[model samples]
Target: MTVPFYMCCQYVDGKFCFVLHEWCAKLPLKVQHHVVHPAHTFFLLPKIPSKFFGVFNCNICKLPSNGFAYGCTMCGIYVDINCAFIPKEITHDAHPNHLLSKVKPLVKLTKRNCKACNYPMRFRWGYDCTSCDFYIHLDCALFLPRVTKHKCDEHTLSLRYEPAENHISEYFCEVCEDEFSPWKWFYHCTRCAQSMHTTCVPLILQCEKSRMTYDSGGVYNFLNVKFGGTLEIKGHSHHLTFVQGLESDGRCIKRRYVLELSMIFKCLEFALMDQIDHFDHHHPPSLVHLQQPSNKSEEDDDEDEEKDEDADNFVEEEHHGGKCNMCNEQIWSFHLSYYHCESCL
Candidate 1:
């Protein structure tokens, strides 16, 4: 049998025990030695294909793992390679004074949320400062990148760890169109007025290379063809031309229509419009308008607003009379009404 060069193991009492190679020597000493978690002596263990173990989830992040892990056989405690090397302490721009200590929430009485991102930390491992009620996710504490570029936008985006203190309303990601807490980290392009969630930024930069494979699903080919370009679909007769943000009739398409089309044809190679040339044709092909229908009434809008207000009130009542779940700040009457500290809500 030929053994993979990247894998190394030892025969311990008749059973195979995985061991870290020289590549793992570059990892932090704490993780390598298991000094922080004495009960669980960490070892590099690769995922086994057998059904005996069932599914293994990381104790720290609570996310399922099927890759290289640092684990202990005796206690059955395991953590993914990324979580194993998380720093013990971190200082974020949002909370600079006290070093946020990496900790697992011991109490389950109150719902805990990260102060930096305003995201719930019920089962995830994150950094916290008891003194200031400051908490943040391990990924957020690392401050992944300072700047990034995405194909969705023209200008480069700069990381904004926290919004300005004076700024009030919530911010929404331009790409996903989902609202994100202003207190959390995000990417912003000042010139283009584009803002995206830190999590969403990575998806924009994913490799555009097509995955070529033959399967029963008719030989899927993920194409990265650009707009206004011609591409051949499997069964389509005419070469499909990509046209975005506009109808074939030259009228501006609605934003919602573009978003809907993008979602529906995300992985498919069919074009939104088709252009064909025929010698016998007497006149040019009539352009089709790609307009989205909107029939929302004023009463419906008002009802929606009322429902949102009611939900906000209910949340406030649930967390009222207690400290802010995120920052640990005293939840005054006014603060309780908002369900967050002045810095974040």
Candidate 2:
């Protein structure tokens, strides 16, 4: 079952999908100085800018935003309206002059670690500095509220990015009683002399409204978005919006939390897929898949196959409605994110 709201923001279609809350729907169209990408202005969008990815995730918190999101359409960078306030440039005492830029790693590293937390960053969306070798997880770079409250402390706990000046050789979390990296950020209460790991901090939600909604009898949790309807493009008569991805998706968008390792894997898979059509000129020929609606007849398919010998190269399909060749598991491609290479085809 889904909760109801008085008003909500949907997408390009005039009808409501019940995703964005009323206040969040009213966010600014663009901002010049957000920390998520200080170098560029982000335009508030009804949906993600491109269709190369089956999912659209915020570069800041690295969570999927299926509704109203602010994005740099030119750079293909996006963020949830929920995380639009965090800054791109921060000055942390732990890593002073913390100027971070959103980055997508080129290849998979078996065991990579964040420069700040000494925690694994493999398959993660993270920030990096070009001037230096500094690398920090997007999760670590943000979500550490500057101040918080917990059961153990009477006073508000302040986040300390660096080791305290009067700290001993080693420190431990007062809440979990486990040792954590001093080089990473932690919450501390000065009056109570209490310390806590960033992960140990309980989620303190600011509002009852979550990024979910109800419509009809089923509960709809909007995660990553896949294109559905068609839009008329100027100077073009036929439909340009895609249908293969949408039909394969079957309208199932899975519910996911940010802390899961599967989230990072999904992020990485989409980042790789995005490279296929990152720019207008550099876009692969496969983009032609979207030029026509997916409801093609057998004659149309045979005709298309006759036109190009390399036509199959465009889809990179493993097997439609079958087990993935790489992971060897049943996959609902649209549920999270998946990479299907042509090797198994």
In Å, residue 85's CA in model 1 sits off its true spot by 2.6
Query: In every candidate, how many clashes are there?
Result: 0, 2
Task: Summarize candidate 1's per-residue lDDT along 45-65 as a digit string, tens digits.
Answer: 655334133235666665444
Q: Model 1 residue 109 lDDT? A: 11
Give candidate 1's whole-model lDDT. 0.52
TM per candidate: 0.46, 0.38
What TM value does model 2 have? 0.38
Q: What lDDT does each candidate get?
A: 0.52, 0.53
lDDT digits (tens) for residues 1-345 of candidate 2: 144335456545676655544566567778896665779888888766483333577775555546577878788888776666645555544466756776554355335567545655555556777577677766566645678788777899988866776685678776446666566667888887778766555523212112211110011123333435455545644554432221112222333233211212111122223324212223242211223347889999888777654443333333444554333555442334444333324
